[model samples]
Target: MVDADQTFVIVGGGLAGAKAAETLRAEGFNGRVILIGDEREHPYERPPLSKGYLLGKEERDSVFVHEAAWYAQHDVELHRGQTVTAIDRGARTVRLGDGTLIAYDKLLLATGAEPRRLDIPGTDLAGVHHLRRLAHSERLRHELKQLGRDNGHLVIAGAGWIGLEVASAARGYGAEVTIVEADPTPLHRVLGPELGQLFADLHTDHGVRFHFGARLTEIVGQDGMVLAVRTDDGEEHPAHAVLIAIGAAPRTALAENSGLALVDRADGGGVAVDESLRTSDPDIYAAGDIAAVHHPLFHTRLRVEHWANALNGGPAAARAMLGQRVSYDRVPYFFTDQYDLGMEYSGWAPPGSYDQVVVRGDTGKREFIAFWLKEGRVLAGMNVNVWDVTEPIQNLIRARTAVDTEALADPSVPLESLT
Candidate 1:
């Protein structure tokens, strides 16, 4: 068992790692805590990278999880821009990029996911960007300002959350925007056809163009700068800048090299962990985007990438490190903001897991709560442009009682009374 006198090492200084270090101090652990990250900045939040930060409404300091002085006061060593090269599980040590070796009694691997890069030609062009870090957002912001001056077009490669959010931000800057997606509708896999159509319509109403069932074949460039994006059908869309938002893959290369077991990529790949976030090797734990956790609530192994999972997974891993028996059973939750719509969703039901969707408000008006039911049991619920209904929606999911579809669809019936 890890005690107060031993060193606890945390890899990847993102939200999950920072929160775990904070939890250790809050739980009365007086030992050394080292948080290592490859980036040159303190641990910060990523959701704002595409929203307020990219839009210039949020300042750089506001995105940080904690102030720089907080680490010093808490006695946690902040090692920025340092990469962990290897993990020696037998020796309980990690080797840094600069050949420094650090020993730890307990280690937490929070190495977060990386944005999936486009492999087509011209990916190395000057105006092509991927949104994952603060630096990426800063570059995109500068590019957007330049496009605003020229009234140029900004082409987004995918219609996912990042793609649509950036489209909204670019449109706000008075730039022509277009989104290309292979799916029939935006967010179709997660929200299904009917709801995905709503998002597609929302973007269209805001002056953003969409090309559905389109796949990028190559990015055309001139003098090492992006000029246009060419699709598979030999169609070229003019682009002053191109943002790739093709989703992300788990950062599991470090764990794999260290001989930790990982689930197959098809099965939500990452460092496989049980309910308490303990990896195959008991002394090490993983959380955030890098953990393929066995969720007790879903009864399936899944890896979540949203803000809520990282916020909750950090503290749970800390408790397990302290030799406390803990189970991670929190319902998976996430939210998205696009155009004039704001939504919060709770519970989990993968694509094809539910048979019916019951909506309480108006889908055409974009104000409603949609519930995905499997055999009358509420599997998931989402509130779009609706406020203060999250608890009631969550309670209905937790009750796991079969709900009547007609009652669920009736706007007069309160959601809390469903079960």
Candidate 2:
């Protein structure tokens, strides 16, 4: 049933779009593949933008999904620096920013997410930054290096993953850092207070300052350059630069304009898709950060913005577009590396979902695995400085069976046995 003349168009050139195109060829589909992206750079993974690449541990080329020649050799029509302005679902064609229209037999909207901008004034000042794109990382890297050499100070507006990671990187470069958050602790929404304190302590030990229970009200600047930031608590901190790491918002404008079904903002806004990653329009599909998939295993709609989701979701969407059945039920997974601590989290455990948290190893030594359990069933797991346990951890979550609390908290007990 693979039609050689059929054309498949992919909008967005991030990991999801690039991998989908790769999967199409790998799955023996010789159809026309057209990929469009606004960014001039080739498709690349995003994790490095906050981790290795920002810290100067990775080369620029290492972040790319594929070599520059790979697309040409694979017969993929790569359209870098091109934006798909409008998607006409009825016409089965997409209008580019330059007024070009491309027809497609099947379409995939992998058009990821964008960083949420600070609503306060002085955000347009020259020393204010956001870390979402490779260009942003590159500029920040240079700024951090210069600041490190001059003993400059960086004021971060949020204590989220991006903020903490950038704070770690800035500290590594010997730049002074101060993070301000409205929550009581860092990662309050994701890890909760029980483990959020651990990250706060880790960063504090590395000389990173924390201003909790407050939010940035304005960025004070002079001559279009940031000089300091003022908190709602009437506190002003001297800053050579400011980073807005609040969060990201899914780019769902094109989908909305095309009348595609979207999840309500209250339930985590995104393009609504079934387990197959197919949208309300059968010929159109959504993937990556933009797709709020109705997970078959969890029996709920979930939108994962991490790199793992994009990595696997792309290929799954590709297979589904090829007339193959695909149920994307991969557990939500993400990792972080800050200072000397590295950790991986698996599964979903939002605030009211879990009743208790259990730890398997030593917390004082910064080596432990925390499990959130609801009614004795594992809802999520996080291993800090723990190795080679993702498989068993994911298996435990997938099983959805009640696990003994004592055994779950015992390091000597094998996790595989519990599952």
Candidate 3:
């Protein structure tokens, strides 16, 4: 049942692609493995780019998934600084930008996502930045340091995770930070008004200014350098540097060109995949940010763009490719570290999905576990400064059983006992 001649080609050299290759070897797949990526650096994790690395708490080497020699020793043919221009599904081959064609028996797409660009005028001006890649982080670190030394002002558009994290880092460097968000509260779409205000308060207490209910209209520049930013509210803030942290869009050009099915943009655009992470084309699979997987547990197609998904989804896809029975039902999880407040969120409860939010512990002290419950059933949970409760929290979501509201909000009630 095994063939050494079979070759598996993986497009994208991020954490998902790298882990898939590692899983293939660990699962005893003797077939040839070829990995292709456009970036010059070896495959690395993206979290550090915005977290430890940007904050100068982590070295450049710590971001990489494996040492440079690991791929060579593992017999994984890595193509760095190379792009897969097109996929010829009929011929089962992929064409590289250099015009090289490589055949494959099975193909995996882990192309990840790119930062959304600001469409306003003066985007090309110097000091206007977007943080999505390692190069961008490195450049932003230098800019933040310079801004800190001169007490320059940083104008950030969009109060999403990236925007808030960058603001925290800037504040750590003693730089002036002002965030302009169109939404009424920070992380409005994700956490809703109840908890979103918590984040807004946290930043305000740290000397960061917030311009809510406003959208950046244009980046005013002088001599091809950013001077200030004008918001839709007709307010112009002097800024030495500007950051656009709107969000990220999945890289689905290759999948689209190859005729792979894609999820609608409104429903969170991505490569449509089944529970096993298999694409419409039987020979092709998708994982990570690009895979909008039909989750058996949630009973809906969900595309999660988080570090945990890539860390686990890649190996799951790899096992599925090896003809192993697989079902990807991992609960959506993500965490954030901003200033002294660190938090972890498990499960999905997008606005309107939950009826009530119950909190345990002390919100005033910034140590609490907030649960989103629908009809007394836990849909999601977020622990701020609370540790060792992830398993119990995820278990509650998986159980899908109604819980007593008073008991749920009581700190003396152990989560494990409730589960």
| Per-residue lDDT over 1-419 for candidate 3, one digit per residue giving the tens place of the 0 to 100 score | 34788999999999999999999999999989999999999999999888999999999999999999999999999999999999999999999999999999999999999999888998999999999899999999999999999999999999999999999999998899999999999999999999999999999999999999998999999999899999998999999999999999999999999999999999999999999999999999999999999999889999999999999999999999889999999999999999999999999999999999999999999999999999999999999999999999999999999998889899999998887
TM-score of 3: 0.99
Deviation (Å) of 87 in candidate 2: 1.1
Candidate 2 per-residue lDDT over residues 1-419, each given as its tens digit:
68999999999999999999999999999989999999999999999999999999999999999999999999999999998999888889999999999999999999999999888989999989999999999999999998999999999999999999999999999999999999999999999999999999999999999999999999999988889999999999999999999999999999999999999988989999999999999999999999999998788999999999999999999999999999999999999999989999999998888999999999999999999999999989999999899999999999999999999999999999998
Can you give the TM-score per candidate against the true fold? 0.98, 0.99, 0.99
**Pairs that clash in candidate 2:** none
Count of residue pairs whose backbone atoms collide, per candidate:
0, 0, 0
lDDT per residue as tens, model 1, 1-419 = 35578999999999999999999988888889999999999999898999998988999899999999999999999999999999999999999999999999889999999999888998899999999998999999999988878999999988988999999889888889999999999988778886788899999999999998988989999989888999997789999889999898989989999999999988878899999999999899999999999987677898989888888898889888888898988878888888789999888876799999888889989999999999999999999999998888888888888998999999898887887
Candidate number that wins on lDDT, 1 or 2 = 2
Cα deviation at 266, candidate 2, in Å, is 1.5
Evaluated against the true structure, the overall lDDT of model 1 is 0.90
lDDT of 2: 0.95
Stretches of candidate 1 exceeding 4 Å from the true structure: none
Q: Report lDDT per candidate.
A: 0.90, 0.95, 0.95
lDDT of 3 at 203: 97
lDDT of 1 at 21: 93
